[model samples]
Target: MVERKLFAGHAVRRLRRTLALTQAAMAEALDVSPSYLNLIERNQRPLTATLMLRLAETYDFDPRNLGASEPGGGSDAIRRRLADPMFADLEVDRAQVEEWLAGAPGGAEAFARAYDRMGQGGAASDGAPDPASAVRREIERWRNHFADLDAAAEALADELRQGSGDLYSAMAERLRVRHQMSVRILPVEVMPDLLKRIDLHARQVQLSESLEPASRSFALAERLAQEAQGEIEALVRGAGLDRLGERLYRRHLTGYFAAALMMPYARFLRACEATGHDVELLMRRFGATWEQVAHRLTTLQRVGARGLPFFMLRTDRAGQVSKRYAGASGSPLADAPGLCPLWGAFDAFERQGDVAVQLAELEDGSRWLTLARVVQPQGARAGGVRARFAVVLGLSASDAATLASARGLDLRGVAVPIGLGCRACTRPDCPQRSAAPGGRARLVNDRETGLSPFGFAGD
Candidate 1:
């Protein structure tokens, strides 16, 4: 028979040493006697139940792993803290940090890392991001945009569900009555607001603004969506999605109308399913960019139609998180903590010119299938410098099995150790990083390297 042992005494000793915290400090945090902590560290005495709970609850350490077990998820987040310069001020030992990570996990670190990343702040700058103001702007925009769309969709959904002769016909009838002009799409070179009403001679249409290919496409889509609002509403209402699921469903419903007016959903869905979610095929079918194809793919899950549920995020080289949208009828990530290393989505950007596909599991014990690739967009006309953005999409692992990559891998009952690669991340030891944003030392620098990148409170 095999013999069992106590928790990882080595890990306890190591974590304390790495944090550069003295035995007294550790004792204070754990609410235990310094002598008791010293004895536990030296393995002279086992950690008691009260001490264990204190470590887990107070300092956010895991008591189970204290006996002796490999670290599970969230170790990356914890490890990132060692990279902080604060540790350097006190001279935390590297061996100690590694040993601590090798210990057992407390709870989920995925959410914790995300919260830390976004909440971290630095010294003041003249023209930097004002998080408070930025959040207010985003909230206001969402309230206005979503509230209006929700009202419009609700009215149309009720109208069609109550008495539907045909979805598009009703919406089209309403549009013609309101605008008194038929929807006509012309090739690019012509639109100036991108839409307009011509009062010349007999009668005519208007162009709101001159559009580049992408903008022109969306313009046509918007008009199409307006024309077929009734049909789209019917499709959304019939889906029977949960509240969060319904929000995502309706958002996609509107997008479907826009895309359909251009490429048509029936045709696109058939083509996509036939091709097993091939980007090239979908892009060619819709005359869209790779990013657009990725965004559109997230729209397939509606009305329990059994489509892959996906979330999409787009960011530029400057690290501006421009767009983020969740797809499908449901997601534990419908409210993901935001970008964090434990998630492993950013690893896709390692190779500048390649598409990186990865399977990631969150701290919640749920798995996500991800596809990430970079896109370089040229500026409009003349001489605008090239711009680059990384786009990523993720979905529930089970819903993505139609793809061959996820088939053989045992997503459940298995834990994968992923690294957090940047101080910008929850992962530590990412040499590629120059410094944390806002020029502060990372929260984890050890004493030897007194100059850690940047220090953020969440760490």
Candidate 2:
């Protein structure tokens, strides 16, 4: 009997496209020649075991599918959707499904989304959580980085820049002069549940008195963003998307403008470089919150004056990632699902004010230095829900020497091994492993149990 070689050209192509890498770039990362990758993509050559392991190690790929031992297409999702009782009588063949997935991947994905939406509640899904999930997935698809908006924000910052002056006051002044708007800081009792509200008819903006100066200034900048809505909307229009897409874009734009106004690009970039990208110093200097400083740090991509490329991750106490930002130098941490419980982000909750520094080694053998600190949301004076989350700022291990925060620390010694998510991670000895991974078969032992709850096939 002869064994057949499996070809997964589509999956390889899809992974490369998801990473936004060119053939040459993807090939280099996979440690293969571009021509060889081309052959593999064309199904002219079978994806080898060595190449499969490389893909799993370097990227968020399932090792099981890399071998093509089972079905390796969108057929599974489509079949699952078709299996629903709503389509109980309908007949679909495996070949036809494969054909659709192979030829029309986007349509297949749309079908999945539509199927999901239908099951969740359809047109009535309005005001429901489905759109929020869709919006989040969309943001994740773009790695939470918007180039056009980032450029416009930098331009605004440059225009509003002053020599050793307060940027927030400058923004307020601009709003008053250009838009005929009055800014008022009202008492928290009067404002109550609202942090800021714009009375467009009255041409006045009211903010809560309970907020700190930074929060008040950010609220003012957001009002200014509304004043420039025409300009901002024009920029958003060119980006091109559906109604919901425009909403997400506008929300991001509002926040971007606020951050830019709070920490004008030129001055902030200079200060970041001078302070060796110190978060505390930046926060104190700009009168911004730790979350705001961390967010602004990810936007320091101004052509010749670019700061060190950084990625920001915000997670709640439960370890669910809520917000993420990837810089222009290319998002090495883009779509990174590794939420290792041991990450300092979780530890920050217990550590209180202290920022925890950690060195993380990924499955690919690449390393990053992560700084984690807890952030408490303001505007809680109204008895509103106050949510506290941890924000982690990560930079390449190579950039540690350039940072003052990591000064005098032995970068080589305290390194921790981490994986993506439990379902996707294959770390066998991880005592923190919560679930079995996809590629490996779970081994059940009635006789004895180990430190880790689950064991894989090899173990």
Candidate 3:
């Protein structure tokens, strides 16, 4: 096992800022000397396991944020910026950059912010202003677990489910009794464009009749979230997001609440551990769709009762990503555009029922065991063609043995090399090159045939 260190100086500083506590005050709370805390904040000392536990217990810190190389949000973007040719003469290394992130994350962010402002006025910039794409990149670049929202959802689950006769029934009862809102199963014709809708004027929550009982219950939970929207908004406010971002996070939290209500955290973790993270069995047990099960697998970041840190990717037939979730910051799956078409998720479209098991190696030599399959929309009428989407669930190579899908596979053998995307890919001999790499590339024709469609002249 590779040793994962705890270089969480930035996290500690962030926590202190959030609590509005001075170094001495935080030291007193953590039962550490002020000088020790100072050393930790300066990246001069690594946090011990005991101190890490204390930090979590005292401040309700999410354990995932304390990783040695945890992305400090702007650090990854800064690293990408530094990779530009403008900084080629500078002696910058990963270790130095990480230390800069740990010791002075705010300064790094200020630099990025200033650089972005300078780029807005027609100045030369490393990257361009693609806010829509940048939003997606920023959102998926890091995995931050908000413990306040999670605890709130878990508490609601505890209240709704008593002895667990039927979780759906319990939720329905809670909705009826507490909110006085009735759930009606309306036909698809009545609610054509949307899956669920709330009529505040009539105090009725309407769901599509074609949905299964589990889906209906989840829709009702989403309505309940609307009724209790204030609570979600409060959590979003505490999350330290901007005004626009808070609105987006509020919607995300509501979906999170629905999922948490469907499958309680403790029960879900127990089921995952018992079944070796089997997707099919979990779907059957939880009455969730394949996509729902896969997405939930990424959100199991509870400090004490955590499951496998699996990242999820869902893409359409055109290789455009519809949804992506990372278990933690700096996920390899978040790399964009040049995702090799050879990924098994795309293959799942051709081979419908069969699961595509792959041992994929990234450009950085990190390997992952991925299981992918296609899932169609549930309850499609007999005469109509259903929309199919591919979902891929993967984890680091070390966790391959723990997954049932990885069994009977030669994981140690040569694995397929995949890139971030076609534009960012650097593989010189890819047979499936749809386009050339990002920067300028010299053409090498010489009136001679080559294996690849586009060949760089220098090579």
Number of clashing pairs per prediction, in order: 41, 1, 4
Residue pairs with backbone atoms closer than 3 Å in model 2 (clashes): 338-420
lDDT (tens digit, per residue) of candidate 2 on 1-459: 122354566678878898899999999999899999987775568788789889998996875433221121234335544533234334565677766655655677677666545432234445333544444443433334444455556666667664326776777777788888888888878887787888889888787877788888788777767655765787566544567767876787788778876776777889988999999999999889998999888876543466777889899988778786654323334334447786666888888889988888765566788899988876785456878899999887876777987897677776788765565566778998887764467888999788787887752
TM-scores for all candidates? 0.44, 0.68, 0.82
The regions of model 3 sitting more than 4 angstroms off are 1-4, 14-38, 49-93, 110-144, 226-231, 239-244, 377-386, 457-459
Residues 1-459 of candidate 3 have per-residue lDDT tens digits of: 233355668778888998999999999999999999998987778888889888899999865556422443544456555544344346466788877877677777566545444441235455544333333333443343445556666777787767456777777787788888887888878876567788888888877888887688778767666555666766555445555656666667788777776777888889998898999999889888777888888887665666777888888888878777765524556434436787777888888977788898876687888888997776566677788888988888777787788777777788998876665566778888776665637476778766677776332
Better of 2 and 3 by lDDT: 3
Q: What digit string (tens of lDDT, one per residue) describes model 1 on residues 220-295?
A: 3455455455655654455344455455555555664554444444455677677777776677655677777776
For each candidate, the alpha-carbon lDDT, in order, equals 0.50, 0.69, 0.70
Best by TM-score: 3
Ranked by TM-score, top first: 3, 2, 1
Q: Which runs in model 2 stand beyond 4 Å of their true positions? A: 1-164, 226-231, 329-334, 382-385
